[model samples]
Structures are given as C-alpha cells and as structure tokens.
Target: MREDDWLAARFEENRDHLRAVAYRMLGSQQEAEDAVQESWIRLSRSDPASIDNLGGWLTTVVGRICLDMLRLRRSRPEQAVGEHSPVLADHEVPDPELEAVQADSVGLALLVVLETLTPAERLAFVLHDMFAMPFDDIAPIVGRSPAAARQLASRARRRVQGNPDIPEADSSRQREIVSAFLAASRSGDFEALLEMLDPEVVVRADEAVAARGAASLVRGAAAVAEHFSGRALAARLALVDGLAGAVWAHRGVPQVVFAFTISEGRIAEIEMLGDDDYLEQAELTIIEK
Candidate 1:
C-alpha cells in the first residue's frame, strides 16, 4: 500500500483507543475529537517509514495535542480543573461489553482525580500507570527527564492513594454499591445510606452549569444521615459507567445523567454531563426534561 493508504488504515484501526485517551485527558468528547483530528492531519503529512512504533507514536501525537489543548484553553471557563466537572452529574452510558485490560482506568471519578495534576504530571502518570509505558518513553512525551517522569508518576500515585477515593472494581461489586445507594435513597433510610458512604465525603457538580457543590460535605456518618434524612428520594438513581448515580428527569424526560466517583466507599466526587449536545458523542441517551 502507498504510505498514505497505510497511514489511513492504521489511523482507522487505532481510532477508538486514540479517542479514549484524548477523552480521558480532556474530559470533553468534542475536544478529544478535535485533538485526534489534528493528530491525523499531522500523521498524513509525515513520513511513515521513520516511525518505529506507529501505535506509540500516534498516541504520543494525540497526547501532545491534548496537552497543548489543555494548555491553550487554560484561560477559558473550561480551563482544565482537577477534574472535568459536568453540570449534569448522572449521565454516563458506557458499553457493558467493551473489552480491554485497562477498562477500569477511565472512570469519571478517576478522570477527575487525574485533573488535579498539571498537564505534564497527568501525561506522565497516565503513560506510566494506565498504559504501562516505560519511564524512558514517557520522558520525551512530556518533555521531562526520565527521572522527572518517574517523579511525576510517583507524585500522582501518592495523591491518588492519599485521597480516600474508592478504587474501581468489577461489575458485581459495582452493583453492590449501586444497589446500596439506590436502596438507601428509595427506602428513606438515612442510617442505611450513612453506612454506604465514607467519612470525608464530598458531593460536587460541574460549575460550568451547576448551581451547587455539595449541599453538605458532611464529615461523619451521622452528618451524612442528617443530610439524607428527607432528601434522598427526591433524586433518581441510574446505572452510569457501570456504577450507581443519579439522573435528572425533567417533565418525565431524562435531561441529565450524572456520574459519581466513590472513594473509601463514599461519594468523593460527582460529575454530570449536562451538555445535552455532547450526549451523543458520549454514546449517552438524554430523555426529555
């Protein structure tokens, strides 16, 4: 095949993985698409023969583009935060059968945790932790020394481990938490709800379109119980990204799907995808209201 044809085929084959990386980095499917498209443009103009590891090279290109995007957009409202907080907290719809060794790495909560790091830190950590890219390979990707990359990964690890967020788990365990959350909400049992959450829990929605950050970031079990005493049932629960979360149904129509990040068994972070326009890109369904 001609070089261009070969590049095209490779791009097609790697599109999904490329987009996943971009999306996780930037937290906006539109932004990720833009980054990937830009990478393709660069790829089309380059000589393929000089490339040794096309997959790794393409991923680097996309990662760099995303990093630049993150940098350039730093002044905008969407300036990369410690996380991509969506206005609608409960709208994630992930493919149940998607197979991959790192499927659990892309949780909304985890992504938010990723947001806390600087661009270089995020890149270094993701390449080393999520993809298992060697520190030597990761150094050039972030324009840091191999030692620096290693340090960045180490720092990122410390932050993640220190923060009391629950590590992502299998589907059955996910269902257990979801079920417990849902049951607590539906049964009007505040004590049961308290038992399901961790002590230092926070409930925040995206400020881009959200009006509130936790109604109350209660400290202990009793405080959590007090907060949920009469308010739990007002919200509706749905399975998002294979975890239990809330979906706001307006006028009997699903308007937003929110996803939560659980840590230490409590809600550590909450993200909502309220931009209805971006729902389709995320493969999510938005009902009426």
Candidate 2:
C-alpha cells in the first residue's frame, strides 16, 4: 500500500476506539462520528512520520476535538443528545459502551450524568476511567496539569460511582407511558399530559424544525404539555434507536422522531428530530405490542 493508503488504514484501525471515546465525551453518535472524522482529517494533513504510538496520538486528537465540541455544547441551549440532567432518578437505557466487551451497556442514564460535568471533567473521567488512559496523557488535551486532570477524574468518578443503582429501564413500562402520552395528546387531555411529563420537562427541536415557526426549546410541564397536548395525532409508537419512542411517518417514511429520556414514570425530556438527515439515520423499529 502507498503512504496515504497506509495512513488511512492505520486510522481505520483506531476508528472504533476513537468513536467510543467521542461518544462518551459528546454523547451523540453523530457528533462522535464527526469527531472521529475530524481526527482522520487532521491525521491526513499532519506529518505522519512525527507520530509514535498512532493509537495514543489519534486518541489525543479526538480528545481535544471532543473537548472543543463539549465546550461548545455547554454554550448551546439544545445541547448534545443524551447530554442533559437525568429525567428519571432511577432509569437507565441499555449500556452502549460495554456492548463491545460485554452484552450490556452503561445505559443512557450514566451519559446524562456525565453531561452535568464540565468539559475538562468529562474528558478526564471518560479517558481515564472509561478507556483506562493515564491522567498524564489526558492533561494536555484539557490544558490542565496531570494532577488537575486526576482531580477532574476523581470528581467525575465520585458523581458517576454515586449513582450505582439506576433503576432498570423497563421497555414495557416505557411503552405504556408513551402510549398514554400519545393518547393524551390525541384526546387533548392536558392534565393527563402534565401528569406524564416531569415538571421540568424539556422538549428540544432541531434547528430546521424550529425555523419553521415551532418553538426550538420548550421547558416546564405546563408549556411542554401545551405544545404536545392536542398534537402528535399522527405519531405512532416505535422503538427509536432501540428505546421506546414515537415517530411521525407519512406512507411509511418517517418525518419526525421523538426520542425520550424517561425517569420516575414521567417524561423528563423529549428531543425532536425533524432534520431529514436525522430521520434517515434514526434506527426506528415499529413496536408491535
């Protein structure tokens, strides 16, 4: 293989690992993939000969890229998918991180907790705790000393380890809740809708969807209830990304995806995906029961 081919091949070898780190850092598959791709781009443009331990180098690059992305996320209202306060005090979606080495995942609830962490804290925690990277290696990425990085990891670890028993996410219960929500929306049962939603429930819409005159971000139970109640008549139940969710489809083509973060038997947050690309990428499985 030629030099460029060799370089591309080497990066490909670390792609999965890079993507995993990014996912933990950013909590959105799309953004994680973007970070990995950006790393590849940077690799292609840099002096390949100067690099040693390509895996570590790529990891650091992705880490820096994700740090910047996480910082940007902090400044945004919509934030990253799955990166928000845990809606449920005791609920966890299937763990995605452990899917590689084990059959189970760390669950979406952990990701939500990680979102509460600052950019540096997240980087330090994910890299050191999740990937087993050393604090020394993590420091430069967050622009902190090794000791500071260790402290960041320690703080994050305490927060993460403190939540040991996130309630087992029950798909059956999820289906029922979503069904009730749909029923309430269709029948204009505002009270029922409010009951199903957490008081601080937040609903986020894609920019494209928001630009069309819909509210981009709706917060509070009353406001969120007012938006969904008497609406979503066209939506039907589906296993969005393998979790219980709802979708709005026309003639089998989905136009919208409603991803939920449920907790304590209430809808804590609803993330709306109206972007065509997001709809296309959604892994929607029609729920039969």
Top of the candidates by lDDT = 2
Against the true structure, what is each candidate's TM-score? 0.49, 0.50
Residue-wise C-alpha lDDT for candidate 1, range 40-92, written one tens digit per residue? 99998888889898899999999899888776766575554533542223565
lDDT of 1: 0.64
Runs in model 1 deviating more than 4 A are 77-103, 164-289
- Show the lowest summed lDDT stretch of 10 residues, model 1: 280-289
> How many residue pairs clash per model?
19, 5
What's the TM for model 1? 0.49
118-202: candidate 2 lDDT, tens digit per residue: 8988899989988999977997888866645765786677678764232346777888899889899999999999989999999
Evaluate all candidate structures by whole-model CA lDDT and list the values in order.
0.64, 0.79
